[model samples]
Target: MSARVTLYSRPGCHLCDEARAVIERVCTEVGTTYDEIDIDRDPELTERFGEEIPVTFVDGRQHDYWRVDEIRLRAALGG
Candidate 1:
């Protein structure tokens, strides 16, 4: 389930920060990597993810919203 991890985020988002921390920690532990996209920078992304920031995508599919579950992320990444 875990391939490319993408964090759809925005500036000044506390939840996004938390989610990013979890993603960074997990991905580092698992030797995986992720990309952080500021929704504010992209119109389409901002529109799609406007309401729910801190959205996560695994392998280009939506995984979690608003938060990152470390255990679930670890399992999904096959760690």
Candidate 2:
């Protein structure tokens, strides 16, 4: 399957940094990969998630924003 996780973020976002750490750890433990999209690079994404960076999508659906919950992420990924 393609990567089931997607993180929408921009550079220098502290929450995005934190989310990345959590996603990396959880995805690694679950043997799954993820995609990271820089919202700043896309006008649509920037408009959609400008105020809510660090957004996460699991299985093509919105999962979380601003912060990442490790347990919830693990559960979502069926880790």
lDDT against the true structure, per candidate, is 0.89, 0.96
lDDT, candidate 1, at 7: 92
User: Tens digit of lDDT per residue, candidate 1, span 1-79?
Assistant: 3448999998899999999999999999999889998989889988887879899998788999988999998888889
Model 1 TM-score (2 dp): 0.92
Pairs with backbone N, CA or C atoms under 3 Å apart (clashes), candidate 1: none
Runs in model 1 lying further than 4 Å from the true structure: 1-3
lDDT by residue for model 2 (15-59), tens: 999999999999999999999999999999999988898999999
lDDT against true structure, model 2:
0.96
